[model samples]
Target chain A: MSSHSLATRTEKTEPAPARTRRTRNRGWKPRLAPLSILRLLILFGFGIFCLVPLIWLLLTPTKTDAAILGDFPLSFGTFDRLAAAWQHLTAYSGGILFKWMLNSVYYSAGSLVITIVTGLLAGYAMATMRFPGRKTILTLTLLSMVMPATVTVLPLFLEINAVGLTNTAASVILPASFFPFGVYLAFVYFSTSVPKELLEAARLDGCSEFRAFISVVLPIAKPLIGLLAFFSFVANWNNYFLPYVMLSDQDAYNLPVGLGALMAGSPALHPERGGSFLPITRPEVALAGLIVVIPIALLFLIFQRYLVRGILSGSVKS
Target chain B: MTTSRRAAARSSATAWAFTAPYALLLLAFGVAPAVYAIYESFTSAKNPGSLGLDSYAMVLHDFRFWPAIGNVALFMVIWIPVMVCGTILLALLLHERVGRLSSTMRLIFFLPGAVTGSAAVLLWYFMLDPQVSPFAPALHAMGLHNSIDVFTSSHLAPIFALVAFITGVGQWIVVMFGALQGIPEELIESAKLDGAGPFGTALLIKLPLIRKYVIYMMILAFAAALQIFVEPSLFYSITQSGSAWWSLNQLGFAFAFGQGDFAQAATVSVILLVLSAAAALFLVFRTDFFKTEVES
Candidate 1:
């Protein structure tokens, strides 16, 4: 339960039953016992449970619009149909989906950098320095982490509108850049990972506290910085409610809001919305949905270990 | 000592300087919104000084508010326990000695989790679509004749809860699996040596050991369920019930965007904010998060 164990992606499973250790043992490999069969069956069942829908989703764009409903759920259609889906998706509102992707990257990446910088500075200070309002700030930051996002979206909308910053990318990026979770993560990482003696050593060598943090602290804080950056990017990239409320211009939306628009605008989904004339079919929406998800899927596949580690360490204790 | 005092003052100054950015951001975005929520919740849009608790009262009496609360309440009451049990069961299965196979299963289980709130809802919508759904036959089997019938008002409670539970459980499983992996190999070995079977060992020892983590997921789950918006919004095809199927968040958002009712939105948000604060305070106190790292 220590943070060290939590950091590892795979826990080296200890050999079960000491008898299984030696190849020279006369004992045969254990038979497929009833329990083992049951376990494997259950595992297979769970596997199908989680994967089928996702596979079904990925296959959607391959089918023609009519086939999307007529074909069996798991059936595959031609690549020619997939091309059609892609073409229509790209043509929607002169390729608005691409802009949403760009905006998502823009907002999340900007927020990620800001969150990391502010979080590192604040976390390092909270953990290592004696600021006057340190305790109060720490308390509030933790409180903010748990507050449901909707609670803030209302007033944040009002505040941004008050300054006439609404409908701009900053309206989304600026609010998101203030990441309480990132700040808290940085605090925990510094507290656990960076020894106070290291900072003290720098101070004794005539280094200023701020200078030491930049010169010494940040150098060794790469793992934490990477973790915080990843978390911030994911949180902001996937953010829906903030940008949904803040941005009025469809051109400024991030992936989530835009995907919501794409889904709702589908001619098949809502005939009442008057988008039936547009080339927005069920298949096109599916393709656009895939476009929004593919990057996140790739990120999870590559850095799943860190993502899992980050979530567990932040949520649970030893 | 005088020079040291100056040095100390300067060090404190640096600390303040370091924290100032986040502190200001937190104030402007966090505390300000919350303070504004309280302010706006008491006043009407027409007049700022009307100091009547109309919004809060209206929040209570809003026909949509009560059903929205009921919808979420029903979902939480069922979904949290089912999700907890399902996640624990999966963690325990993955805990067994099935080396690479278990890891592969873990990977597969974790993939669905990467799909976030709005996307997950949309993906599931296609899966549950009557004509397109693989579950079409299953829906028919349940005496639910069509896809529309499946997403009908009476069925909204179960359908929304099912979507949340199915999609949300994977992340929690991965989290609990991490906690389960933290259990020492010797504990399971000793239980086996004592002639305890797998069930007894998992039931009596492993589950109890990870009970704190379960409760942790539960608290997080409770907070998450209370904020259910993205799924419910996607599920809100026909808003005849207006706010009936809407979670607190959907209701709040609708008030602001759909109706131009900022006061009502702020009122609901303040209520949710209070609930969130209570959960957060409980989490901080229950765990070792607040103590000095050295002590932990």
Candidate 2:
């Protein structure tokens, strides 16, 4: 993909001289028409359409319950209400929100580290080493990649329960670290992006397979590794049902599960909870939801280029 | 420099080193639980339960099982086309237009996808709720006053399913855009030079090239949709009625986990597994989905 862009760059650079020559020979000026006008219009319209909900989410925190329901959807209600909502959400249930955020960070960071390391090692082996049953391993990894995490969540929960680790951080993090998709992404990246002759030359120069992988292949695989880490982190952070079912203790809940619990505890939503805003409310649920999305949105803004490349590179083949 | 002795020694030593961790983890988390679930599916017992196929029988015999299947079938029928068509259209739009604004537009369209499952669901829940949404007036104009009322037995599954589709379009759009960007510009230019209009170029040149990607998107969408959870689970909180589990899926999950019937939950999971695996296998073997040509 980079090579394709490089070719385009060279073409653009070379075309500058040719354009001047053509104009001189023809003794005429060329029209400088702007391309992509229609595309830009459509994309801009779609971008606003896509952002409406998020904009609404951001504006929502500022409103009291009445203002949230009665006022304009996009307008801010009061700055005080935003702080009030945050305070209420944090103080609700003995400040369980902090615990949930910590749990999310632990789960996402722990799994991300393991996934990147394992994916790199496993992907490097598959790409470079001609091991027995390597094909079988690749096929199994692909199959696992396509299997929905939800389908396996039940069995996995039970397994974790059997091991007496259901409510612990490990239950979520351990399963999340074994992302088959990341492994396959790394494998394809290493195979296609990294040249094989480089590794062979390094091996012939007395580097062991492991050393060759570390020194020669690792540098090339760095961009892909970063991409995989980000993907893994986002996936683990956003995970819901696994932790929802596995962790019963409120203190162990991650943001998604915590938000769900807030919804469940909302009095207007749940009649059993006696429909009051003393404990939790719709605005608090909204606030929690906003908090859950903020980190991911921040990460995306920071690494937008790599995220796009990672996803395209990972799935374009299939 | 004796190769045979070195090869034998290396093979023996490295065999465990290479396969041990993956094999152990796979068995402990993947294979063992799957086998145990299947085994438990056939049996009926308490927490420290007995072994047999009664659980499967009970699950199949339950009135909810078939209905859940029907609900998922209905969801797939509605979901797959919307996702595929919307993604393709959005991707085409992004690829045709190249500018700074277009780049920013692509980023915006891609933002919702970056937000994970729970956040998207919650966002949509608020968006769809009649009380808080900007769309309330429009819905009211259309004579639908109560948004939550739309989640009746008849419309509940479909509405939530549509919500799921809308929230998920971001990722699909990104995927389709990537495929669109890969089409050689020369092909498009030549088609234009041949007097083919934009619609004709899209139909003849672009759509055909990205047909594999469309199928890929469909299979993936189907697999993901098969395991619909958060929306319905959230809906349960609003609807409080026992019949909230009106959808076969909600009923299955409610029976298995909510009602302490692990065997039945395992059965439902197994059924989901089969459907997803079938879709996956169809993509892998029946199509050239993953086959890559060697770049010359």
lDDT of 2 by residue, B168-207 (tens): 7776766676676667767887896797756788889999
> For model 2, how does the per-residue alpha-carbon lDDT over A38-135 read when each residue is reduced to its tens digit?
55566667677778888898888888777877888999878788888889989988898999999999999998888887777777667656556666
Q: Which residue pairs collide, candidate 2?
A: A267-A275, B42-B52, B42-B53, B43-B52, B68-B248
Candidate 1 per-residue C-alpha lDDT over B86-136 given as tens digits, one digit per residue, 9 for 90 to 100 = 899988987765466777888887777667767876777776666787767
Best by lDDT: 1
Candidate 2 TM-score for chain A = 0.84
Q: What CA RMSD would candidate 2 show?
A: 4.6
Error of 1 at A100 (Å): 1.4
Weakest lDDT window of 10 consecutive positions for candidate 1 chain A: A17-26
